[model samples]
Target: MKVDPDFLDTLRLGGEFNARQCINCGTCTALCPLGMEIMPRKLFRYALLGNKEAVLKSTEPIYSCLLCKMCEANCPGGVHIAENVRALRSYLNAEVLEV
Candidate 1:
């Protein structure tokens, strides 16, 4: 699928999540009990590559996030996972729902 170059730009311009800061660490996925099949790392990777389809298709995982910050605590890269999830959720609301 073609990548949307403006996907990450839109996310960044929104100034909510910092997907660019992720270091591909698996800590976030591992810490999530509700995310066994879905991982934040994968989501962030999609966002970084401008894969809007992948991001959109991952609705179940995105909204499933508890925003518990367990991943944030375990993140060695210091990625703001909670904030990023919030931003992603907001993006989904605005883009998918056209809110």
Candidate 2:
């Protein structure tokens, strides 16, 4: 699967979304306040799989994030939930039409 250079750069800059460490443990989802509705854990899985469509479709949940930093705090792998979310938001903003 070809990865998006911009997305990869975002991950690097965000200092999270550790593509190497994620084991699909669902910890991020369990800890996420939006999990009941958004399901970040599943989103992360889609991202790791390089499913850009799924990732983009999931952007609403990513943007809905309150940036509370709670998910990152509880992440055993230390994923930067807020930063990654912000990066995804930025990517979505640039890719989608405002209308």
Candidate 3:
């Protein structure tokens, strides 16, 4: 997938979540009871690298997130996981749905 290069910077403008803090430790995914299967870690990496298309295509996992903070509580990297999910939803609504 082609990287937009500016996607991450643009997402940061929302100031709701900080994906950069994530260390890709997989702690969040392991703790997820909802069986997220794909999420904040992989998605964050895509976001960090500005892979807009990859991130966008992950709508199922993104929207499937319960945002229960289950992952956030155990996150060793201190990533605001719920906030990141919310940010992704917001981005999709604004940029994809044009709401």
Candidate 4:
């Protein structure tokens, strides 16, 4: 997908921050209780690729997040998944207000 440059920048800020350190071991996904339904790893991939449509369209799953921080706790890279999710939620909320 052709993601907008501005949106891509946001993704980089959130996704690239610790992406190089990620091992893609699936620990985060495994540790995430929500992974029973939603996949944080997939969300991370979409964020890394700057797929804004996918990310934003998946906002419902994002909102379903318990923000338990379990994923962050288990992340070997210390990627702060909860914070990224919160940031994305904030961005989406602001966008909705502007619409």
Using lDDT as the measure, the top candidate is 3
- Highest TM-score: give the candidate number: 3
Task: Return the TM-score for each candidate structure.
Answer: 0.89, 0.71, 0.90, 0.77
Q: Tell me the tens digit of each residue's lDDT in model 1 across 7-95.
A: 98787665676766677768788889786555799989988899999999998888888888898898988888888888888888877
lDDT of each: 0.83, 0.65, 0.84, 0.70
**Is candidate 1 or 2 superior in TM-score?**
1
Query: For residues 1-99, what per-residue lDDT tens digits would candidate 4 score against the true structure?
Result: 866657746644433333545667888778877664445777767767777778777877888889898878888887877777776776677665342
Number of clashing residue pairs, candidate 3: 0
lDDT of 3 by residue, 58-90 (tens): 989988898899889988888888988888888
Tell me the lDDT of model 1 at 16: 70
* Residue-level lDDT for 90 in candidate 1: 83
Error of model 1, residue 46, in angstroms: 0.2
> Distance from true position, residue 91, model 1, in Å?
0.9
Which residue pairs overlap in candidate 3's backbone? none
Predicted candidate 3, C-alpha RMSD: 1.3
